[model samples]
Target: MTMDTAIARPELLLVADAVAREKQIDREEVLEAMEQAIQKAGRAKYGHEKDIRATIDRKTGDVRLSRWTEAVETVENEETQIPIHIARKFKPDIEVGGHLVDPLPPIDFGRIAAQTAKQVIVQRVREYERKRQYDEYKDRVGEIITGVVKRTEYGNLMVDLGRSEALLRRDETIPRENLHNGDRVRAFIYDVREEPRGPQIFLSRTHPGFLAKLFAQEVPEIYEGIIEIKAVARDPGSRAKMAVISRDSSIDPVGACVGMRGSRVQAVVAELQGEKIDIIPWSPNPATFVVNALAPAEVSKVVLDEEAGKVEVVVPDTQLSLAIGRRGQNVRLASQLTRWDIDILTEAEESERRQEEFRRRSGLFVEALDVDDVIAGLLVTEGFEGVEDLAATPVEELAAIEGFDEGIAAELQRRAEVALERKATELEDKRRALGVADDLAGLEGLSPAMLVALGEKGVKTLDDLADLASDELIEIVGADAMDEDAANAIIMAARAHWFEGEEDAG
Candidate 1:
């Protein structure tokens, strides 16, 4: 032991006490920090600061700094050693070669040693803070975080998320809402991920998957794995469609996501800034899927065209608006939900489409024809709802209606003359549309062109129209003109067509 070891001992302990009192930490932490820092400083100085030794007592929380050397047979280096007999003077139990603990006298640390201590302390603190940050966010993934909007830089949203700021990109922001500095809002934490800039917080408003994620948070069944969200399709704020399957079967997936009385869905909708959500059941069958997709709007029939990724859903004429939604949102979402192109129509539109189809199918109207709505409606009002009706009916009979006139009769005659041709043309168009093939097979799709072809072929009589064989017609008229398909289409269109004369007379 040496007198120099005693000098600095009191001062080192005093620093430890002072730091503990100021930082309100356990005394051992401050002493341990000092011991580590002083050792690092001594290492940096090489032999220059050989007397600077530091120790922290684990039991008493005491800190001490001193200089000493072992009593070795021979001193390898003077900086860390002492003569063997010199170490034995401090203790009777100490042999000549045994180590001795010596105290260093109080002395001002040089500029370099002080700087080294400071660097080590700073590095330790930084490492501690790093671990603290990692622990803080690691458990916060997939949770909602409330943050105040900080600033906007080139449409990028900067939000102060308590301990750190999160960057919400332009695409992640809600479509109609603009974030201003100091706006308070909540966002879902898509992920807590390490990035070059540190933890990157991803926010989303338009993501289709976001809907399901949101429900999983709010719905107990979903969180417990009782309900599974099958798929989601969104139009951002205005509309979104989702498909859900109940794992339990007993628990309703749609109702569960929608909440008891909509409280659950309202929470999600509020977070989405008023986005509309339709929770529909998922079906493996294409027909069933199409029906499910047109939610909040009842579907009577679903005609599938799976090969073309298309489907036609039929609804009553009155539900036309609801089925299509505002600017066709319902059908659009349905298309997104079912992954199929959907064509929507009112009964009237379907009827009009049927007429076009029949014209093609019946070999009636060939091309370049537009039927005015008024005439069509008039004919529709008069039981001549389709071209096939006019094709089989006598021109004079159609003229017998209230607005009857020779000119009107001739017009009816012309229309009926082209019925089958129009129907056949319409059917071909519908066929290319890749919807249901049978959708055009109904008798209501007749065109006037078919009627003319029929009259020319001596099939104008009512008895003839009734007895017409579509297959025989196809054989006689050639596949390109009037094939069996054309004959059958003509008969179907005429039967399906509403005769204005008959309807008016009735």
Candidate 2:
């Protein structure tokens, strides 16, 4: 058929005027559809997010198109083609090996899908516009936004973020923070994405930074840089600790955050529904910093291990229990803020930890414990099956064995001492590390056989008993068969090692 026949028959467009009569959409949109349809039929395929332009006659709804290319010497394929002579018509200067794109319209556009494709092209354009909007917002994730609560659906809150709806997940809600219809809520937009529905923006109030940003919004000193938030830790809806500092000596960071008569903080607290806010002054000195972090608790001394990033906080015997907190929460948060391992204890426990460190760092472990790793090699020649069996034989008895020499025997004795001490120390240290408090005294009172039995059960040190309360001791030692006082006596005896022996002697 000729080009005129194809134009009269039309493609999926049905008729040039059908757009004005039926789809009720602007005539421009229908023209865009026809242009896109003709462009797609010329290529005979749908192209994705690409930059191919098309022009449709506003009057006839017929279209033409082209893609950008440079004039090239060798034409690998045929889509965008230009003879070297004809290419100079568009460009005054053109090269043979360069690129060129020549405009072309389908001679028989109606030969492709006629009416059906016109409808599909319009739908594709609508879908593309939706995606365009989504792409514009997807990169704007993790921004704080103000949005009205449009409504709640399937437990997910849909917020109208002006041009888009952002999803506020159920878990991200500040605990007990409710929303009313049309209530304008301020939230941190945690994420944005493209989905079938549209742009998906995830908001969060439980996020700790949300509190910091909220304060920044409400406090001018912070926004303007007179005051800055150094650290923020939060248990949303319950309490938060924020450390602030001031660049200007005249401005008090804490006072600025707290505002006059607690007014500034009260506004944030009210937004959080009476959640407590502690505005602390930031400190450069780590020990001072930590004492501040463990607020409400009196710290006697703060010993920090700089290389290992560990802190040992010594409190008075009276404050030890409180400094450590319920389930050790106070020290735990302090550890997170300071980015260090924190050991919280009474003054007495601090002294013992130092003593334990001395024992572990002593030369006994270096030369002495070196023998443990290769004990298997020595045993192969000497006929001992395992470490415990070799240990059961005294140093002198092992010295008498065929392959053993005096120096090797002596080294073995030292290894045993360090190994046994370390094993006991580790058992004790593990308990202390678990946020359990123990007495500074050692364990004793148990009979020698019972002591040996306890070693077999891995209760090698007094700290082990400290980690376990009286009930745990009973549970392990089988109080089932023992009389009540006997079980209680055994428990007391187990803890007697670290204490000094009684004054009177036989």
Candidate 3:
């Protein structure tokens, strides 16, 4: 190409404008890329070791090339740096560390140099496009976006999302859902990450947020913030459960999400390829929420074990199959929606288990308190769980039980205290036999029974207990004995020696 075409090429500005418009990127970015390409070609024409630079005038599209050398007190490199005395001789007011620039004649583009310049421009433009895509999509995470399927690779779909392409991985697609090139699809933008190859925009059709977003689009009440989605659980293409709450008491959240004749939910289900959805009203009461989550099956009773994050649901005998769903889908989804572990039982099974527990506790009272079956049964019926409960109860409270007076209540409390003392002595003997340390036994949260249990598990030293995580300690001592917070405190207490050693050494 001629020097005038290469130097004052107004066509270069037109090309940058066209590329910037097509890529949906800033025109300034395109100009910067073009300058880099010209600078690379200039460096190839000049010596590679010299610092060659190029710039394009924004208004006229006039390209200028120059060589730069730094004036340093010591000449470190022959090509890029010059001695301060020589630099000052050329530019009379030059200071050390300042750069000196020399204008050069425009380069005549050879075939290889033209090809190299094109590659550099293309690569820079691609990098700018990638950055633009990342910046645009990163904050759009958790939103639902529509795109056309561009192609597929190894069961993954590459979707053209207007200006950028996103990958819907095989596992992120709803099971058995099919898409072909040019097919319109809607998915959730779950993540955007910059990777080695390029910025990756990850889309998911099976994400629970996708279902929630669909409801928001279809239900005006939800979109306007009158109704809110609390939680969602999906088996993806099979079934899903969503919990919703209404900020306005007059509007029913579930009814509003269902829309007129189920239009709203049906739209979401159709998009998910016939995935069945159950929309339930959410409650602040976890028990009520869990009962609602297990839809289509009537729950007779709900019991929560807060420490373990577990709930027990009792349904009638006929509702067992429906409550658990096919292969436990219903209960599993309910558990996930409520963030609880669910154990389902029939009414008959629950009643049988209650009777069995009554018998066991009554038998213990009878053996330990030397009471008759009638008296022991009465204690168990009155909610006295063990000898500890009986000993802890006030004599007046014990005497308040029907068919009991002050004399009987006093005798019972005395016997309960004796039994507890005997149990503690036995546990302490067992703890000693197991070589449990005295310091561990004296830990504030640990009881005699817990000490013996820990000793049996070989956690007999403070260091051993300190090494255990809160969950590990709970598992060894029994979750029913202490919750995670108490376990963590006990472990922290055990670790006190470690910090003490550090202080001494310091």
Could you say which candidate leads in TM-score? 3
Residue 362 error, candidate 3, Å: 0.9
TM-score per candidate, in order? 0.48, 0.55, 0.90
Q: lDDT tens string, model 1, 191-297?
A: 66765445666665566766777788899899898888877889888878888898786777888888878999999998888998888899888888888888678
Model 1 alpha-carbon drift over 4 Å, by segment: 1-40, 47-116, 150-155, 180-183, 205-210, 213-225, 248-251, 259-261, 296-332, 335-506
lDDT of 1: 0.68
Q: Weakest 10 consecutive residues, lDDT, candidate 3?
A: 1-10
Candidate 1 C-alpha error for residue 369, in Å: 33
Estimate, for each residue in 1-506, the C-alpha lDDT of model 2 and write its tens digit.
22331233244345535753553344555566667665555455434332355666554545556564545555554444556666777776887765554454444536445554666676765665566557767776656789999999887788887756788887888788878779998888777677786567789887777888889988999989888888887777876778889999998888888889888899999888787887778899988988988887898997888966888888989987677766776677666666678888888887787667544444333443564434435553465543445566787877887677877877776666666676767655554444333332234344333344445556656666545555655656555434446655656665565454653432
How many residue pairs clash (N, CA or C atoms closer than 3 angstroms) in each of the candidate models, in the order given? 68, 22, 0
lDDT of each: 0.68, 0.67, 0.92
- Per-residue CA lDDT of candidate 3, range 199-308, in tens? 99999998999999999999999889999999999999999999999999999898998889998888988888999999999999999998899999999999999977
- Measured over all alpha carbons after superposition, the RMSD of each candidate to the real structure, in angstroms, is 20.4, 18.6, 3.2
lDDT of 1 at 301: 70
Candidate 3 matches the true fold with a TM-score of 0.90
